[model samples]
Target: MKPPDGPDFSARWAALRNIPPFLRMVWQASPALTLAMIALRLARAMVPVAMLWLAKLIIDEVVVLSQSGGPATLAGWWDSGLADTLLVLVALELALAVAQDLLGRAVSYTDALLQEKLVIDISIRLMDHAAGLDLASFEDASFQDRLDRARRQTMGRIPLLGQVMQQMQDVLTVASFAVGLILYNPWLVALLALALIPSLMGEMHFNARTYALNHARAADRRERDYLRMIAATAETAKEVKIFGLSPWLRDRYLTLARRFYEENRAIQRRQLTVMAALTALGTLAYYAAFLWIIARTLTGTLTIGDLTFLSGSFLRLRGLMEGLLSGFSRMAGEAMYLDDLFDFFTARPRIASPERPLPVPQPIRQGFRFEGVGFRYPGREAWAIRGMDLELGAGETVALVGENGAGKTTIVKLLARLYDPDEGRITLDGRDLRDYDLDQLRATVGVIFQDFVRYAVTAAENIAIGRIEERDDRPRIVTAAERALADQVIAKLPQGYDQMVGKRFARGLDLSGGEWQKLAIARAYMRDAQLLVLDEPTAALDARAEYEIFQRFRDLTQGRTALLISHRFSSVRMADRIIVLENGRVQDQGSHAELLSRPGRYRELFELQAQGYR
Candidate 1:
């Protein structure tokens, strides 16, 4: 479903509701820093009014001294003690100025620290929440967009913390100015509000429009970023160059970027036009109030100090009001983004361990059984695997063979419970797979898919990820590497197990596809799980290497249940049983020699590959 073009009016105000929770997050990030920021800002908020009042007093005193005709010379005035009050007042003003600067710096320092803490806190939360979601959630396009927005919010919404605090500070400052203005004339304060109200409304409307534009373009922005990455990244560089795709990618990025720029420019243009006119109205009101102040002074109805204070107060109040209004609107817009972050947190995994989950059984009894299982990927119409009955008996080595899109990988995912079957049930030792603790069940099964991640870390670290809890166990890492025959590949590297093995980082060594496959295979061994799955684990290796790897695999997994997926008939020929899948169902199951002896899809595929070898 398409997201709304933008939030509506009520939605904009409702977004404000997010601020309280957002502040709570900020407070949680660092309570001491949060409190320090508030205190510093509150202290700074009163500085402006105090300084202005002092200026008024100084001016009034100077006027009185000049009119009194005290002394002819500065020395004479000072000796007579007439200039004493002026001297003390000036010194006090200077002190206040210094305090203001120090407080401003303190607030700035505190804000910076608080913002960093909030970013880290929010980023960690986003990572943890994303990790807990079901694998299917990551596959959905809509979910991807939401995830993207939420990820952006980790850094993007951080400024809202400072903005909120500043808004509060501005509120206190505005209240102080308003009190002084009301003392002179309540109508002046009312007039200022009337003038600024239009400007505030204009700001709100435009900020809402800006937010809507960005929200609608989230998917486009993601695609643009992807294009940007593929055009320049090491992984895609070879393919991009070979295909001569630079122009296409550049044009696509430019198209999306241009649209974003144009939409932003349009909103900015309208905001400029409307806000400028409203701001001019506010200027007129300030001048009108200035005229009234001067008239009162001329009539002797107000003292010179009153005129000075009232005029300065009016000007400051106008600027403060404008800032408060605009800042509030911007904060509201930012609060809308908070919805994305909080909404992401609200997403709970559909596949979770049951309450009072049973511990996963050790030393398998009946092994795994899929009874009339049916499954489909999220947002997909056709089933990936349906009405399938399969089993991996204890101590049995089984292989799954199929054409492309024939659900070989789907079977592995279902066995690992990356996704739950939509129909029927999958059981382990007569108990439903869902009945066991999710983490424990996964820990019991080790799987290495064809597209395993080539991490930009030391070779040992890459293997250690399989059972991260045992990352520090050097002996285990080495043993796993030897079992997968990855030790031979690592031995050639200058730093052996410690060498970083990806082109993504500098001072890193890139490995060949087969070598990387060897490293990936080591991860499975590192797990030492009860049920092992190698899905196209040797795809990048030659026939000779593939045969050697499987030869060792069969020996290492002799008494453990293993499921293998491979297109190479040579690799599966040694398995105790081979299951052939067609569409989403098992078509046949037998020993390789038995299948080859029969006239079936399995035999046809075997002959086709064998002819290639011949």
Candidate 2:
């Protein structure tokens, strides 16, 4: 799908609508910090005007002292107390300067702490929300693009917090300066506004264009990140070297990054050109105001003190107004990113449990049954499974034999409720699967697919992840490991069960394919699940090892319902009933011997394997 176009002028202003919600998240992160920051900023905001006003007072007092007849020497004036007022003014200005420094430090410290808290809070919310979403959402290309944008916002939008606070503080400072400016002549304030309005509009337009460019490039950025990962990561390093993929990966990354840079550069160039011209207009307006102040002083209509005050206020106000306008435009652009985060949170999972859910059956008496079930993955026209009917009788060991894409793994996924069927119903015992509490239903089943993760954690922790609540139950962990023959693998490690596995981290030892397979299988045994599904679980193991593992599996899971998927006919022959699947439907089913005696797909496949052995 084509990426959505960038926000227009109206949309940029509309993005400010996100500010309130974003502020609420900031407040939610830490109320004390938010309140502290605001209070400190308010105090700091008034400092500049107070300091400027004091400078005018000190100047006026010094002028009076210099012109009036008084003690000629410094000691004579100090002794006579004639310079007391000027000294007091100087002292007050000194205190204000010191106070400003202290307040500035306090604001920085508070802002730093608050930024960290906000980042942690937003990150946690993102992880929790993503966890509750449907698995299909992660698989969709557009959804992934949105997710990438939202994830970037977690860190990328943090500065918006300080930017917003700074903008607010600057507005208050500008208001104080404007009050003084208005007393002299309101037209000076009007002229400043007239000059800056164009600049503000220009800034807002360019910021919106920049946001639009980033929004459209989310996919390219994600691909670039992926390329960077594959080029150097531990998992891909070996293949990268052997396949000579470094140059190709580097070129692809540069290609994407260069396009992004060019697009961004174009927007920045236009902004620089337009904004520089507008800024020159503002500078001209400031000098015009200065000339008016000098003329008033020369005419004796304004005091020298008044001249100093008016000119200083005008300069500070101009800079503050410029900063306020530009900062606001940037904040609005950043606020646009908050839409990605809020939009992600707004996504609701379609496959969640009902409000009132039945408890999953303890013993799973009748096991699971799929009734004319049909399902297709998101963005695909071809159904992964269609009109599929199957049954797993309680306490029976069923073996499914099928080539890739014959719906073997899809059936396992359906049984686990990772997805609901697009068309028909699935049931546990006599009740609809959807009627059962989703979590409870999943807790009752244990599945170990062929491509299980090799976690970068201790051997024991890796196995414990299957049923994490029992992680501390050492005996159970050990027993499960021994049952899967992973105990032998762990025993060879430097720290035994505590040994960190996977080469992803330092001081970690990697395992062979067969050894990793054993560890993965151990996770299935860690669960106290009634129904166990093993999909090509022994593919990494040698023939003798596979036979030994399955022998132990059948012995350990004697009364539990089990479903096994494998291409090796030798393994399926041990199942009480073997199912042959073709084109997403069950083609044949019977005892291994029964199927082999007949001229069917099962017999044909067995003969092909047998011929390979011959």
Candidate 3:
């Protein structure tokens, strides 16, 4: 199906009115700075009004001086006073210009302070929520997109709010100009306001399109950005060079960036042309009024000074109106992006703490049972796993063997409670797994997948990441590394456990494939959990290393229930029980001796692998 059209601008504007008691919150947070900012803005505005009035006086007085017939004329009487008035006006203008500059500095510093506070507040709040979300939700793309955007862009809202503060000064400046022009023609003020209507409309139209573009391209933009990172980042550089794929990847990156730039620039060009045409029309009308006032003064319908004031104030009045109109639209557009950020900030987690959670009842002693379990992903035609039945007794190490698409990972995912079963009950001991606190349940299980991460940090940090809270426990970290046979790696390093493990940063060393697998095993061993899963965990290890590691793995999982997957039949032969699966259904399950003797699918698959190894 086609995706929905992009953002709704009208909806976002309404959100500002709903900003949770706006001024009160801002006032309570920084009242003194807020008031000081307003006062400076008001004082800056007065300088322009006083300048226009002085211009009108000088124009009329100079014209009269030019027309003087007698030696004692109005100009002669006021010659010395004119110099004083001009000096005072010049001084006022300079002082106001200086004050505005000071205010510009103050606003920048104030914005910096506000932005820092916002980032801190939001990061803290989001991190707190992140710890509460289910590990399964992290896999959901929609959830990830929200979390990513909020974390990256939410801090920009503060500067937008500061822009709104500046707009307040612009609005007041416009009002003062209108009041000063009243003596010439009251209707001229109304005309000036009317002329701004087209420009305001044009601005709103452009903002709508811009916001819509942002909303629509968020996913693609994220992809392009991530690809650029992969292309340029130090960690990916070695693999890219060794594989001789840098040229191909660079071309692909340029393709995506060009697409984004071309589309946005097209829209910008169209919008800019429309706004420019409207601005030219407004300029024409403003000058037409200036000429009309001059003609009226020439015909003796108005005083010369009145005409001068009317013309000077008219030009300032037009600028002030345009600034006000554009400022409002700018503020609204900025707020919409903030709303996108806010949406992520306030998202409802797929799994959250119960209103009144019962403490975790003891560790599983009986076993886990899946009765008529089923699950289908969003926008899928069929269930990934459906109506499956399985039982794993406590302390039993079972090996699940299957072909490529046989749903082995799906079952393991369910066992981890990353996604709830659609049509089944999953119970631990005798109670449902969902009834226990999510954190408690997850804390009891540990997993190492074929695609484990290689953290570009210290050797100790890489291992201790399995239990982040226990990272500072040096004894525990060392023990876990020793169990995974990674102590030899530490011994080879210049600084042992303190040595950096990846070359992304300074003073770091890269690892071989087999070595990285050992590090992953060390990470898994650090979890100290009852249920452990190793999915093709030794796929990268050499034959001898793989075999020896299995011997050590037996020691690491001595007291825990474990699940191991391997294409190598040697590992499967050692499991207490073997479950052969074919296309999402269990074909047979029994001890190695029993399954080998039975001449079933397990025996056939075992012989095929055994033939290859020979």
Candidate 4:
């Protein structure tokens, strides 16, 4: 069935229907706090009715005392004993006032705690879900839009949870007032309800329009966020300053923000006009009711206390009804926004493991074989790799040499199963790659891309991230660092392995590009996987350092399979065999001497680089 195209009342109602699940999530965050908040709200809800009634009693007592010739002076009034009833009523009011204040404080405190807990819970869930999605999903612009919206809702709509509780308390308070009015005259209840509907409808309509506008502008909002970050962040500061882009970026932000402001301003103006008209109608109704009550009081049918109580009740009822209706509309809008969060949560990962996954082969004896394999990234026309045929034997080292954009990294990704081939198949030990468990397959191959993350954490923690379970294993960390030739570099720091590595944090000591590469290479060593793919691991290292690292690489990877991608023919020649790639196809494959003996692309490219040095 086709989904609905635009915002509708039904979708808004459905958003309201998500309240139970949201509450359930809040409850799951902290049942004790949730219960405390509810209890406090309930207790606070009745205080208004009690306080109003007590005021009526005190007023009636004052009227009686005055008619019976009360004392003139303050001291006389205190001693006359005619004021005793009033004093007792005043005492009860003071006590109720204190209790109400305390309950309100308690309710707010509980909500604040619940809000933090809910934010943390929702944030964790978002991270976990994003981690499970396929690489393609992250690359798609539409999927990014959905993710951005959901992320904003996670932090932005936290107030919705507390608003729901407030609304509930308001409902109970309104009910108490409604019952009092109904006792005096049932028609008064109907009059108040009639007055509220028009404004309520207006609020609900504007809310839907607001959500629709925000929904359509999600991508623009993302762009605004990106531009803001780029204009002000440490990572982009150098480039932004060099290019003198501050004014341009600022203007761009203003343009987008102004468009949003204009659209929102239009809605707000319409909403205000409708609200004013409806509020005027409501005022007329209230005055008409007020005049009717006055006539009854003048006719000797109702006492002064009754007059005060009914008037107060009617006024309170009007405000409470207005709040309840408008709160409901605002909440519907909030819940509609929650559709983004729920929609993201509901999205199932296409790359999830099968229910009954085949076990990963032990030792991977036959190695990996790709036959007629092809894959194109999402939303791209050309294939990244096509009609590919390759084989990596167990314990053999292979080098993939190619110019930029020749599908070098794409092959590594395919081999690591970051993406499944769109055409043909990849098999490990004669079993299709998808047949094995997803996690196990990833665990079996360790890949370090050219652009690796430089984490702003302790040196030990940085390496530990490669195999997080071994974070506490100091010996394993040391061994991996030693293998990556990072131990001596780390030893030079004041805190050694405990030293923070990135410049982003306080007291952090930044490393040179070569040092950071060495640290990243340590992560692969930490993985200790059977199949290792290194994409230009020595790009930042000096020539001597590069040759030394490759020497260590050959020595360290004696019994394991490895694939090295580089433009440097010096490193490529060290491989047991070389495969030259061009335009997503393997143009040639052989040892360095055999390729050099032939008049082919590999020989021409090799000589081109060699001549540059002379």
Per-residue CA lDDT of candidate 2, range 1-614, in tens?
A: 22234678889899999999999999999999999999999999999999888899988888888899888899999999988888888898899899999999999999999999999999999999999888889889999998999998899999999999999899999999999999999999999989998888888888777787788788888899999888999888889999999999999999988877777777777778989998999999999999999999999998888988999999999999988988888898889888888888899999888999999988778988889999999889999989988899999999999888999998998888888999899999978899999999989999999989989999999899889999999999999999999999998999999999999889799999999999999999999689988899789887678878877887889999988888888876789999889988989999988998989999998999889878
* Predictions in order: lDDT: 0.91, 0.90, 0.75, 0.88
Looking at model 2, the pairs that clash are none
Give lDDT tens digits, candidate 1, residues 1-614.
22235567789899999988888898899999988999999999998898889998999999999999899999999899999999999999999999999998999899999999999999998898888899999998889999999999999888898899999999999999899888888999999999988888777777788788777887998999999999999999999999999999999999988877877777778778889998899999999999999999999988888888898889899999988998988898889888888898999999999999999888988899999999998878999998999999999999999999999999889888899999999999999999999999999999999999999999999999999999999999999999999999999999999999999999899999999999999999999999999999799999989988987998999889998889998888999999999999999999998998989999898889989998
**Candidate 4 pairs with clashing backbones:** none
Look at candidate 3 and give me any clashing residue pairs. none
Better model by lDDT: candidate 1 vs candidate 3: 1
Query: What TM-score would every model get versus the actual structure?
Result: 0.97, 0.97, 0.83, 0.95
Off by over 4 Å in 2: 1-5
> 293-349, model 3: which lDDT tens digit per residue?
988989999777787778778887888788878877776776666666667656655
CA deviation > 4 Å runs, candidate 4 = 1-6, 69-85
Name the candidate that leads on lDDT. 1
Which stretches in model 1 have alpha-carbon errors above 4 Å? Answer: 1-6
Worst 10 residues of 1 by lDDT: 1-10
Model 3's alpha-carbon lDDT is 0.75
Ten-residue region with minimum lDDT total, candidate 2: 1-10
